[model samples]
Target: MMRSIDYGNLMHRAMRGLIIEVLRQVEEGGLPGEHHFFITFDTRHPDAALADWLKQRYPEEMTVVMQHWFDNLHVDDEGFAVTLNFGDQPEPLYIPFDAIRTFVDPSVEFGLRFEAPADDDEDEEEDDDGGDDDPAPSSDRQDAEIVRLDRWRK
Candidate 1:
């Protein structure tokens, strides 16, 4: 049996750390010219905190644009908090790092995709890959479903 280290998980953590660093910089001096973030996260994640109205609007997932007009931006080891305008009402949001699915900085054409933590039941299913009746999605199949950030750039 071959022992395989989970580099993918490690890379995910590193990328998440990068996201935190960028947010920290922005919190200190504000977003630089043409620099903004499109942060996509799973709304159903337990650590995700949002207004009831916003949750009703985005039941499954939500992408928040961190640009002008946001306030009280704070990032910590576990998660981040920011105030965004929803229908002209300032709404507070708290999202944990583990819930983030994608992070994109279109100005620089940079993006990172993360595999969200699987629920306990899903994790059990994933571990039972030995069953011949159920096959897991191939890596290529999963990649095909993800929208490439480069495609959005000129």
Candidate 2:
């Protein structure tokens, strides 16, 4: 005999909930020693909000560095908000938990992948030096690009 079951959507929602919980821990207790996160998400996600100028600047995908001077970090049932210094200006951004596609910290070898909406275009990863790899700046941030985490996919 064969079994018939329906669980795709259920599993998807459950996994999403788990991802949010982990983020909540980081927001509440703070990131573990030397363990910061490289979070990647769709800039166009409905719940994602950024300065209009920022959207034009990043256009498609953006990665935020969550260490050092980040502040006002908050997370809730639907999304999260945080403030970071961009150049000489402080910028605030709100991104829904659902928009987060990849969360990882290479320093600790810990990572998580979540369902992510499709990106309409493909672009090169942006280095931390305000553009691609540059020879002049040595303080540029370099992090792996996070994308939709599809763990169960074959």
Which residue pairs in candidate 2 collide? none
lDDT of 1 by residue, 1-154 (tens): 8599666666766777788899999989999999998887767767789999778777767788888789999999988999998778999999888767678888887887665322222222211111112222223111101336753467
- Model 2 lDDT, residue 84, Cα: 82
lDDT of 1: 0.70
Per-residue lDDT over 19-80 for candidate 2, one digit per residue giving the tens place of the 0 to 100 score: 67766887888777897777766576677999999888766557777877677888888888
- Model 2 gets an lDDT of 0.62
State every prediction's TM-score relative to the real structure: 0.76, 0.65
* Model 2 regions lying over 4 Å from their true place: 1-11, 115-154
RMSD (Cα, Å) of candidate 1?
Answer: 8.9
Candidate 1 weakest ten by summed lDDT: 125-134
lDDT against the true structure, per candidate, is 0.70, 0.62
Each model's RMSD to truth, in Å?
A: 8.9, 10.4
Scanning candidate 2 in windows of ten residues, the lowest lDDT window is 134-143
